[model samples]
Target: MPRYLDRDRLALLAALVAPLAVAVVLLTFRAGLPNTSIALILVVIVVAVAANGNRLAGGLAALSAAVWFDFFFTQPYQRFAVTKSVDIQTAVLLLVVGLAVSQLAARARRLQVVAITDADYLARIHDTAELAQSAKEPDTVVDHVTAQLTTLLHLRGCRFEYGSLIGHPPRLEPDGTVVWGRKRWDVDRLGLPNREIELRTFGNGRFYGRFMLDPTPGTIPPLQARLVAVTLADQTGAAFGTVGSG
Candidate 1:
């Protein structure tokens, strides 16, 4: 079995090297090929790299392609300086066009990933709603939501604390923000705290209980996942309200 480089590392390495390698091959025909055509070829390479990697890799590939194009194909062959005005324009345009296309490619990839993730989140919410509607007891709904949150948020454990707002643990708010004591916690950077974090559940504006989440150390769930967790809690709240009244 052969081990391959991870996507990020491979993409970054290609970004730094692919342009130079391609430019060297084009050097054989530099005398006959128009500089504009060479620049367009480099732009294509940038787009490919961007589609496969992150924004930083895409941007680096664009810069690398432009630099190599200037060095190899422009006037005063093998020099970085461009003696002709037209050659200079071509080089600049190559960089600009490459950067633009790379950005678009990266954004398209991101949108594709987000679209898939959103579909999964919607399915979870829909399933939870169905369970809440048909469940015989509110506790069943709470237990189900507990399991969902545990998996969704990558929590070490999750349990419901009924009544009384107990201690001032960190709270995951409806808007997906985390608050610890009086200040906002930076979940993206710091990850969730080691202690149990609370997500309160409400039924018809009445506080029912809280789900205390023990997060896996260094696990930082994305904002979308956090928002989905909040929605699931709300569904549990509705179930509680319905069962309590009945």
Candidate 2:
């Protein structure tokens, strides 16, 4: 599955399905004639809304039920405009139920999203911790970290550069090279001709180096940057241990 949720498609599907499901349920109970159960229809609407996780679906289901109830089930049937007091109460109740269910379902969906994000973040942290503990050589750690990051974020390619920043910034060729920033070290988003991601890593309050992604520019978002930072910091700390403060 794609990492991000496609809200537009979900909303569109909810809008289309809710009314159709309600219509089907209404038709099923119609054979009994004058025995239509408004409670059953409301239950169906609530289920549909909860299953779909959309407010639009719930609202549409409520409206469809109200219209069907007045025209088919109410006395002096076959008209939209309600004339009876009890019918008015039923319509009001349907609206309230639909809105309430939809609100609750939406809240649940939001929680599910947050949980998924947190899980991904924790998994990244676990991977970094494992790399820090297991790798004896800094290059081995860097290569392992790069491979893990590429797999985790689904990047086409990744490279890490190490060394102090001095002299003019090195030309960031299609391949990787270390470069100096104009001034103090910071994470600068470098734009390439094609859609590529460039992440600069800083550690111990100083610039370490750049993490380059293949092709174009602006491909990596902020969350990915933080993950890369954690992995890079692990590798950099390992490098310092091996080389003794380069």
Candidate 3:
């Protein structure tokens, strides 16, 4: 079960159990501590859970905290019923605040991931550009771009063809659109079509060659990554043009 359990499942389990454990520990001092204070403590727990997990995990933590608070700290102790209206308000706020905080935390996490990804994409482009500028042989640039595309697009393999192919395999356009058999394939929803996707390279308005990409099964690279791959191919094209002119 542990091997099968993913990160999300582990987070959800912690969300469901942490509040209950904390509530049980607080039960010892229930006679002295105010219910409001206990609710505050549970809110802290919910925030902690949300920070480490997703929105759903945060919400479950909040819900669990409220349930346990009602069961252990309310007027009718050891029961779910809450006799005081004040206790009811506290429970409701716990859920509401917990949910709101969870949403904010989730958004922050997403933004952080985007920032890291953007930085990495920039680095890949920068490195490839430098290599293209310094390398004398076009094969060097082609080989570098091929390796980069395989990793960037999560491809099984990538190879460079010296000239344009005769048949119309799916083409990855400059604008990062995938054209397959007279239709623009929805790479986002359907993943890359299970074929050798062609990413053509051009030098000074002339077609030099293409990079034939064999994507892994069910690999759906994001639009940003696809664009980076195109940019890398453009760098390769520029390198070919330089070598030809020289």
Report the lDDT tens digits of candidate 2 across residue range 119-188. Answer: 3433444345444444566566567667765765556787877754434432332112223344322223
lDDT of 3 by residue, 146-196 (tens): 989999999999999887687999999765679998999998899998989
Kindly report which residue stretches of model 3 are placed more than 4 angstroms away from their true locations once superposed: 1-117
lDDT of 2: 0.49
* Model 2: pairs clashing at backbone N, Cα or C within 3 Å: 194-216, 194-217, 195-216, 195-217, 196-216, 196-217
**Candidates' lDDT values, in order?**
0.79, 0.49, 0.77
Better of 1 and 2 by lDDT: 1
Estimate the TM-score of every prediction. 0.53, 0.36, 0.52
lDDT score for residue 42 of model 2: 49
State the lDDT at 132 in candidate 2.
Answer: 48
Backbone collision tally, model 2: 6
Query: Model 1 RMSD to the real structure?
Result: 18.9
Best by lDDT: 1
